[model samples]
Target: MSAVAESTAAFSAAASRELGEGTNDTPAIAALRSEAVALSSKKAWPDSRKERPWKYHNIATLDLGRYTPGMSASNGAAAGVRSCPVTGEHAAAIVLENSDVIFSEASPDGLDLIAFSALIDGRLQKLVDERLGSAVAAGTSKLTALHYAFLAGGVLVATAPNSEFKEPVRIVRNYSGGGQFAAPHTLIVTGANSRVHVVEECRSDEGDIVVMPAVEVLPGPGSVVRHTVVHRWGTNTKVYTEQRMVSERDSEFVSLQIVAGGGVVKGHLESSLVARGSSSELYGVTLGTGNQHADFFTTQDHVGPDTRSDLLFKSALRGHARSVYYGMTRVGLGARNADANQENRNLLLSDTARADSDPVLEILTSDVIRVSHGATAGPVDEEQLYYLQTRGIPYEAAEALLVRAFAGQVLDRVADEALRDELSAVLDARWDSPE
Candidate 1:
């Protein structure tokens, strides 16, 4: 293992000891937890002066230590907590509240589903042992390390080879009010020649809460997977999200992330094409208003020949809100005939609002077919606003129209019609009255 991984494994050991050992954990999981705990002791919240990831982040302004661990109670059992309204009869719903799985339903023939807390020792153990933490290796990031060391609970989902699901699997997680820390983990594996779809939603009630969520997706050879994530937390919530995926030979992966709520949110999304003939599309949308702050980091890695990847992320900022985006597209050595693209665009709606974008590309192979990255941050175009105003649109209405269109560029990519319409309406309501 590398020095960083060793440090994290050590931290996991110590943190897990103090965090309370779970008797349900199998030997491998227990060992993994120990390593994460060992690394946690040496790592602290990101420091603007010391960590590049936190350099543009205002860490000193946030009081994260005040949050306590989440209670092991389901929202259904708690008072004043509301369930998500976005549900369909055709979809399977898994509702997670705090550290408990409140509800889960899926067809046995469609998906092999199991809860992480339920895997003590058994057949699933071998698969979990091999795939867990394989994509985002331990110690890659401090927050990621902490997530592994102290994950609250999550589920594992897999589809049988050549099987198909007619409807999407919807996973909804709700965090309740209080200074609570909520950590949720998810692992998805799709078998060869199979197809799977998943839609995940994260929301919270009114309160000061901190949320830490991690997800890993593995698409087996010749598989196709589509996933969507929507985050809509209250103003007092701060969230750190980690999402990673590894695609195998001849597999295809598509993902879309929509961020619209939370006082402060930071996230990392990565797509790693680890085998030849793999392809992926990554898309994201961020809408910030008031004093909201949103930051997203992304990576597209081509580690095998004949791989292709593309990424597009858009952000709209109003009021004194702030937004930042940084991305990297890397082609590995000997990964010839690889093609990758990274693009980020930001729109500022007020003089006080600010946005920053950085897109980078690293091509390590001499025969890289094409690799490019571009970023742009600017205000609403005056010409376009003027054109709208001249056509009888009010100034504020015209600005809103353009802003909604800017964000819709990404929202429109969502393949689910219901989700797309719901998100579009929410986006309109959110930016209609920006400060």
Candidate 2:
């Protein structure tokens, strides 16, 4: 058999064993896992030379058989205190370790937060069945299929129609254990005219592990939703994330991604404005140090008339770190008067640091208002550094100041002051310490 075939066979066998050992799975979940395993078996492993999305990373080096699926000791029990860094009033908080819920609490408000394992027999079963994989399907890719096949530690957040929350919902996922495969999923569904914000943080222990996280957001008409994800994995961990948002008529969706640490982190973030007057904003900040590699693929999809989208992603790389960004803006034929913009900027702090950026636009409608994109990858300006030095500033401090300024453009856009400050502090620490 070919290498791809062997890898797929090994993964499928492992998933089958896991499924066989699982006795508490609901029928719906069992069916979902079975379908995912079957689909994954038929799909070949992604090849960088053949796939555009996988072009920047090679997965063939990973040993598919060396890692087993992770199991949680929680077993539907809640324990421990919340460890998320985002501090503020929260409507709900859910903490998961190794793809299992260890702690969860929801306020007396109308916001509904529950673990997926508990939702199987609850009143929300129908909702979960309908919206679980609506935004991102299991058949999307091999990695996604495997993610579903080994899905654990899943959470669902929903808002009632016309409801509004003054505080954000917090989610923290912690992964540990060497040579383990972890898959954590989050599903968000909002009713019409509702507004909410979600903050998610991911952390892992210092060991060799692989994580595949998937997030799906579905917003109702006239609703506003904002989501922020913070990634602080260990230097030995590899993470693959898939997050997407689909908006309704007259709705607004905003998303931000912060990458601070990881060995190899790659993700696909997409926003689909599917109804008239819908708008989306995407922002990303990444600090790559040591031998870290961060790769992001983003899409601004306009499927309705008068839709708007804006995206900005910035990264600062030091040591032998590298970063890659590939973004696409698509305006369909029915998307008349669509407005879209994409920008990517990278600052190289060392001669060995590297960055690759590509922004593309595909507009099928001639009545669009505006569509544009820009990308830049370069080192710090010598003139600026010289001027800062002339002002009696030390060379190291001057470079740090320039890097801070470069990252501040995107950080300044965050609406939450506390969260922004915390992220800024994390960035500063990451930039100062050598790998």
Candidate 3:
């Protein structure tokens, strides 16, 4: 039997026990158990059921006993690595490693950096606690249930009312001790009219395998939250992320995700604009070399009048790598003058590399201004390559340069020049020739 089959059976059994008894019995969770079992054994297409390349990536294989109930030592280590990519500043922060709250701090005034436990004691804790389970409950999936069972600590960030943080608050998370599973919890609440930028970086330590399950962001009225996530995990890790952003009236949310790590990563990202004049911008770029894999799904929900949203995602896969994206836009009733757009484009570098792009839109009312989604997947442009090659550049160099230019379009859109440059370098490294 293939590794997925063998691992799936084991994973299903462990997951069933959690889901079966979780939340006083969750039928939906039970359904996932049943689906997982069949998924392990079933094949969508006959004669070709490729074994998942990284059998060691699963997070459940870790020794749960090693992680104590509170923030572990690694939390401090993660905090120590806290950095500001934009302004080149350092921060007083907390860290979570291997789903364990390995390091924590309670330094007030500079920037509200508190662990989840402390936030629970603070005034704003209720907002996070209340909504925590509303969207991604334990019953939603077995993986999250496992996270619930193993989680020890979480990062709690609060942007004080109209408080403009000069240097961005950074919540840095890392993964070490492979063969370990981690459920990381983090929540950010911005006070009204406040503006703050955040950098959430995820890295992994050297080990056999790892699993990461995470969740939500809350941006309030008139608040502007610019959030960036850097995923540079060990090549032997598998990560599952579930995140959502809800924007209130006159608020703005900007999100950027980079997936240059992980052997197998799957997740969903969504934004819901619930008030008038609120806006959201979502962008992502994924790089997969060798047989690495990354899968992402995003949704833009325009529920209020005059809400605007724009989303763009680009992926470049080489070697035997693969990347897939599914995006959707939903316009609700009474959402007048709502404007939204989503676009997905992919570049496949090798014959074995693969990508799937799908974009969809759902409209509930006819009075809306506009909404549309588009997706495209293809290899390098022959014409562009031929033209460059004819100009005296070698075929390899020409292709490389063109490929960089294709991915550059997304980088140029980033507000942070440093970040844009960093992403550009990663892209060039992933593709031997940018063309």
Model 1, 1-435: lDDT tens per residue? 465564344334554554435425566666776777566566666777986556578565644445555356643453432554446633456777777666666456757666676674465777777778777655766677677777776667778889887667777777886777776778888889888878787888778887778889999899988887777888888888888898899999888877878888888888888899999889888888888888888888899999999888888888888888888788999679998988889898779888878887788887977888888889999999999999999998898899888988887777778777877877776665434
Best by lDDT: 2
Q: Write the per-residue lDDT of candidate 2 for residues 1-435, one digit (tens) a residue.
A: 576565555577565547434524566766777888888768877899997777889876677666766556433434555564335667788877786677778544668888787665465677777787788889988888888888887778888989998777898888877777887888989899999888888888897889888889999899989898888899999999888899899999889888888899999998988899999999999999999999999999999999999999999999989999999999999999999999999999899999999899998989999999999999999999999999999999999999999988898988878777877887888787777
Tell how far residue 319 is off in model 3, in angstroms: 1.2
Error of 2 at 119 (Å): 1.6
Candidate numbers, best lDDT first, in rank order? 2, 1, 3
Span of ten consecutive residues with least summed lDDT in model 3? 45-54
Give per-candidate clash totals: 14, 0, 17
Worst 10 residues of 1 by lDDT: 75-84
Model 2: runs farther than 4 Å from truth? 1-10, 13-24, 73-88
Candidate 3 — which residues are off by over 4 angstroms?
1-92, 99-110, 117-121, 124-131, 206-208, 426-435
Could you give candidate 3's per-residue lDDT for residues 1-435 as a string of tens digits?
Answer: 465564453344465354334322233324433554344333221121232322223434534333322223343544443343223443445566544444555544635766554443535555555555454555444455554444434566777777776555667676666555556666677889887777777877656554545556777789988877878777777777777788889999988887777787777788888889999898888877877888777889899999999998888778887887777789999778899999998888789998877787889988877788888888889999999888999987886787678778877776766656765776666565332
